[model samples]
Target: MNAHTKGKARSTRVKEGMTVKVVRGQHKGKQAKVSEVNTKKSTVYLEGIEATRRDGQKAPIPIHTSNLFVEAQK
Candidate 1:
């Protein structure tokens, strides 16, 4: 088994599909649904939250789980 699943459960506070509020950064105070979770990196992708590229394309932004607070679960 890999390091992640080997010994103990991770202390991740957020999970996929959970509603979370941004506590910091440019998107602070915005509430969004958790679209994905990266336990290894401690980051989450919120639905409808993205950064616009120079070419006008939007890409999912990964926010550290610490920067978000769980609002509700879906």
Candidate 2:
């Protein structure tokens, strides 16, 4: 399959509290700060970044680190 077809992925060594940008998925183009780290699942919670319903409530979701590109602060 092509890169587009593949969804979020997980990589190693990323810690919590790092700033990151969405490189893929529905949340693409959004910037967020890391909130939590899950080594076993290889996922991280980005503050203010998540799927939402029509009411704007956050959906239960966690994007993989590989799907996130670390961003440098100004």
Candidate 3:
């Protein structure tokens, strides 16, 4: 179980518009401004972190906060 299971992630220090870096996962080391925060799922959407969909549209992935580190606030 992860921190989300314990519901501690709902109180994450990271907030929307903050600068963050991916500390883990395939996106590791990528830093960007936070676009949104989904406390319900403990995920954060970053401005520069996205994947190109098959339809040729770019979409932001919902990364768990556990894989992110707040670099600064925007």
Candidate 4:
């Protein structure tokens, strides 16, 4: 299969702009709007949910789609 076909086949239920609750990890129990979806990595990025760098900059963290549940739609 080609890269595009593989990516389409692995599409996640979660979509951008949807509110999702973290099911596992340090951020568990927190709810945030989905900001981005990395289908190839099977991960999703949520707004206001990220890691702080030592320099005080917030870095976007990619959480596995399996670790989040759709709480609401945009």
Please name the candidate that would achieve the greatest TM-score relative to the true structure: 3
How does each model score on lDDT? 0.88, 0.77, 0.87, 0.88
Instruction: Show where candidate 1 strays beyond 4 Å.
Output: 1-12
For residues 1-74, could you state the per-residue lDDT of candidate 2 as single tens digits?
A: 86556874534366777778898998898888788888899898888866778998877468987888878532
lDDT of 3 by residue, 1-74 (tens): 88888876544488888888899999999999989889899899999789999999999999999998877766
Candidate 1 positional error at 64, Å: 0.4
Using all chains and alpha carbons, the TM-scores for the candidates as numbered come to 0.78, 0.66, 0.79, 0.78
In terms of lDDT, the poorest run of 10 residues in model 1 is: 3-12
The parts of candidate 3 lying over 4 Å away from their true place are 1-12
User: How many residue pairs clash in model 3?
Assistant: 0
At residue 69, candidate 2 shows an lDDT of 85
Model 1: how far residue 52 lies from native, Å: 0.9
User: For model 4, what is the alpha-carbon lDDT of residue 51?
Assistant: 93
Clashing pairs in 2: none
Per-structure clash totals for the candidates = 0, 0, 0, 0
